[model samples]
Target: MSSSARPARRRLQRAALPISAVMLLSLASAGCGASVGGAPPCLPPEHTVSPSSAKPGDSVTVSAPDAKCDPRYGEDAVISIVFIDAAGVEVLNTTAPMADAGGFNFTAEVPLNSAPGVMAVNAMPHGVDWCDDTGKNNRVSQGELPLERASCVLPTKPLNITK
Candidate 1:
């Protein structure tokens, strides 16, 4: 109300403003430290397969590390297999939900009519925004296998009885 009191009030307000801001910032940083910086709290899950080589009838076994990252970070983990021919054209693309056990085993019957030479297995956590600390939606690490080219398998060949 008085000139002297006005100055004191302004000073107090200024000091309080900064302190409030610092507290808010600290809370925000703690909640989102992982998305902000430093090595990811946890490296993406690791994946592996048994009998790296397999024919159409043979079952393919796959495994991956647990999805330890918080789901709030965005996107779920995806396991996929890419089949490519000698010409480098993708012939088949297969993907399945990652199991809670961090492992997956599914039998993929080779298409009797499919043309194949080599196949590649890949696994990645899709729809995550590792770069955006603000938590905006984005592809943080999609289609990136923890270890790309983890395994290769050949498909079953058709019988040439006529020959």
Candidate 2:
């Protein structure tokens, strides 16, 4: 190529360097957990029941880690536990508000009348009106409820209820 064309090509290549670097940095930041697409990341919170086995009227503690759903719903999500007996009857239901730091503990007595067998324990975001049983719309188990940034059906974990 001519000398004049060579200098113009060099100038264009130099200008592209900064733009490339910026795009790479943006990608790297997102890969490192920074929210992308101007939306906060939505990670499903996990639930754990201490002891996993409890006797009638015994106290059971449910623990949950920090979680995010929809940014519009923000950080304050209600956590609820539904204790169902072997007969599929709900015996005890409790809703606890989540703390600012996200982690929370909810302790409740296993109803003395809880059908003595393996009890099905389910957890879900109970703060939103449509996502809860108390809401007039009653979409509790619809599985289409939006939780923060994602949609999920409520999840259940099992617990041994001994006599």
Candidate 3:
């Protein structure tokens, strides 16, 4: 990459690190520590993304409280991080839990080939009787009152991608 071509990449990297730290610190400094046997309040599937807008290949920070997400796919307790494209297609990414968090967060890259437009991020319930976005079986027959539950739930907010 040329010196000029590299600025965007470098700026994004610099911006991501401190946002991550602040996320962790803010959670810790909340009224009462969460790990001290006082778990954070549950806000089911509530998610927040830093830099609500970005370019392809840019990193966005997604944070969700563990209280709202059971993280159970069958007996495994699985959690998935995914982005919904302009075409409404979901692109799943890997997840890594913070060292000690009262909340859950994920870092994902906007697909490099993504076309510029408005996209959404969703925390698909891995796979259940209602949702099976990945064909992977986890909770094929779960959830009570299935009729009342939507095919999928959102623990996400919109992320706008720029060219």
In the range 1-163, model 2's lDDT, one tens digit per residue, is 7767877866765563332233234333211112335555443356677778999889988877765543233466666778877656789888887654345688899888887767766665565432222213333353323224222234556678888
Error of 2 at 11 (Å): 72
Instruction: Tell me the TM-score of each prediction against the true structure.
Output: 0.41, 0.56, 0.48
Candidate 2: segments with Cα more than 4 A from true spot:
1-41, 68-76, 100-102, 129-151
CA lDDT of every candidate: 0.41, 0.59, 0.51
RMSD of each: 20.9, 19.2, 17.8
Sort by lDDT, top down from the best? 2, 3, 1
Query: What's the true lDDT of residue 85 in model 2?
Result: 75
Instruction: Give, for candidate 3, the lowest lDDT window spanning 10 residues.
Output: 28-37
Worst 10 contiguous positions by lDDT, candidate 2: 26-35
Instruction: Estimate the lDDT of model 3.
Output: 0.51
| Predicted structure 2: lDDT | 0.59
- Model 1 CA lDDT for position 152: 17
